[model samples]
Target: ITVSNIHIKSDLAIGEEVMDSLAPFIVLKGQDINTLEGLSLRQLEEGIFFMVSPNLKKFSRLRSLDLQDCNIYLQEGKTRSRTIGRAIMVRTLSCFENLVRLDLSFNYLLGCLGEILDALKLPLEFLSLRNCDLNEDDLECLANSKHALSLQELNLSKICQFSIYDNDRISSNNLFKIVFCFKNVKLLNLAQNHFQDSSIPSFCEKLPQNLKKLQYLDIAGNVLTEDSTLQICKALAKVKTFQWFRLTCSNNLLDEALGHLNQAHENAVQAKQRICGLLSALGRTDIHIEIVKLSYAIFVDLMDVMEL
Candidate 1:
């Protein structure tokens, strides 16, 4: 059941009883619901702003909940610390005992990280908070979450304050901490966070030393440049579990793109047998590549596209 662009104007129009019989998966993206005044939706009106399904326990069988781009509004007022916000956030989420995947991406969920992580259950496999105005505190909460080990896929793309650079270092450190927590994660997405070449050295030092289970990684649109490409390759060399790695390093130095590719090829040669695919997945019409090594089966299929 997908419920996108839904409008719930009337209070308690959808009674608590209606939630008793819900499907395993419930998606409520781009919803325009005002207040959770009724339907048993949990509301914490204490000087802080936060809200969530209070009656989610009723949907005991629900395994997945998606609230992407819902534009959820918090009650107005400034809270001194994250304690109250975390408590309220936890209260809203703790009821979903059976949830395996939860996506709250593209929401205005500011400063609600401590509670969200504190409230998260241990059964979750996939968790995404993309573009949710997350801060370093949220990443810290995740790094300390009890369910971190259970997560298979984690998405933190575009989580930084794009307009400011004051908190970039803190956020980057917090992100690396969170990454270290989920040792068993299979797929990770950290795209478009603007962690430029300067952060590569830290990435090399903090990134999980050995993620044997990691398969797919997407670090595209991270403002990575040709000079940083080799640093990235060197860092990735530690992640021996990589199977399919997609990178988008364009627009910064098209002339030096081939040099970066050659360096990548040299680095990739070390893991040629382990890597099933290594795509420089970008949207460039002018760029081209030659079949430098036909024996490397991964590049065989991509050979045809190299000319165009």
Candidate 2:
């Protein structure tokens, strides 16, 4: 059953009852229940979470759940009647054993990730936790999750950074560990986070050796410099499977970083051309073939970062 962009306030209860009776894959989005009609995003999210908590068990055959931009939270200092904790959601989620895709992005779920991960039983293929204020504890749970090896696409973009002094914020080392979990990940989005130049070395160091399956990588809108860019380029040079790479790096030093990249590209192309010319003049057909292979390798390295 699919429902979207509707006013279901008057019959909300009845609708949920009917939905509970039928164990179908349910989709609810942009809904305006009567009690939640004029509420703010956060309030609406709370309302939806509460409304769905009691009925999640009814959807035994649920396969996909998308609750993006709902601002769900594990509100504290409230009774069970007023608030739903992450554990409850996790327990409820585990009931959907056949679930494959789960999207709870654009929410404010800070902490409680350990509990959630402990309860996850679904073999999810696509998971989006973008802009959810994820922390180091969350990263730890995700790193050890069984689903990590199976997920083909993982989105952690715009995860809140709180503050530089915040102890719970995810660091470069934590990010590396989280990244190390996925062996078959083809697409990874880490845009709009607090990654910086200091984080580049660790990230490069911990990057998996067998990333030939990766096709798209987005590390845009972070704090980076020319050195950081070079480090990323060097790291990417090791992976020959990428088709698209985007690093907006819209920080203060973008121009300086870009200048360094342009110079590197120029030097690399010139050196390759010179080598190719030398090989051709030697009348060495075998050497020419080797030079062509070398030039293609260099081209692949520059192509990914140059487009950014």
Candidate 3:
């Protein structure tokens, strides 16, 4: 079961009786009854959370866990309780033997990726650490971790957002190298990141070669230049495993991109058509050849802005 926005202050929130009631569904000896694969505990804070770690371990057969925005961290102090709290957190997470999907998004976990990766014996198939205050070290650790080989879907979206200066962006450093490690990944979201204005030449060259299995790629709000667009289309055409890969062309992007669509409708359409033509020419599979998808919102936005 999933619980969210729960300010679990006291032991009564997830008391023993509640835990005991879940036994027939998760633990009792029957194939249908014991099929619980996921448990979500969003916003389950640390204070009373530690008291129930042992009870959570009963969910050993769980294959998915969502602890998004849970503040699953030890408070800073040199006290024995803090150390014990961190250890308990790790130990509890480590007990889930079959876990394949984990969403720790918006957790603000600082310098703790390595410890968590080390604890997870089984490799995760899907992981989302969006807006987690991630750094270069975390990406490096993930690239080198056992999870790297197994990860099929990864969301590192908006991890570097709201920066005062794009000059200090991670893409200018070893971040691309870390990206190269996800050779088997299918769905990869690197949206809303600061791509150095000179552009990701390395991304266009290496992305298709590195992420061969990639089906869906969301590079939506990176302020992509025309050259970057052409290059990305070329790169995407190289990966030939998936059915129909969309280059979104955004017809629009998120809120950030939607605002700009009104002024540049003609240019955007031409650009979108150009990309479709390029993909059609490159031809991973047979296409009708006139492939440009403009969402209804974009169509209406264009009509509103267009002069009669």
Cα-based TM-score, every candidate: 0.60, 0.63, 0.72
Worst 10 residues of 2 by lDDT: 34-43
- Winner on lDDT between 1 and 3 is 3
Stretches of candidate 1 off by over 4 Å are 1-55, 74-89, 163-170, 205-210, 253-308
- Specify the highest-TM-score model's number: 3
lDDT per prediction? 0.53, 0.57, 0.63
The CA lDDT at 85 in model 2 is 64
User: For each candidate, C-alpha RMSD in Å?
Assistant: 11.9, 11.4, 8.4
Off by over 4 Å in 3: 1-33, 44-52, 74-82, 162-173, 197-199, 242-268, 285-308
Across 1-308, the per-residue lDDT of candidate 3 in tens digits comes to 53311212121235555553333234323323145676665554444345556766766777887766566664434689766766787898898888888888767555567777778769989999866765666777899999998999998866765546554334533655677798888888765565553556777788777888887776544555667667877877888864444333443345434665565566556776787778778875432222233343224324532521
For model 2, the stretches where C-alpha displacement exceeds 4 angstroms are: 1-44, 75-84, 208-210, 253-308
lDDT of 3: 0.63
On TM-score, the stronger of 2 and 3 is 3
Residues 61-108, model 1: lDDT tens digits: 456666554455332236645455445556666766666777777665
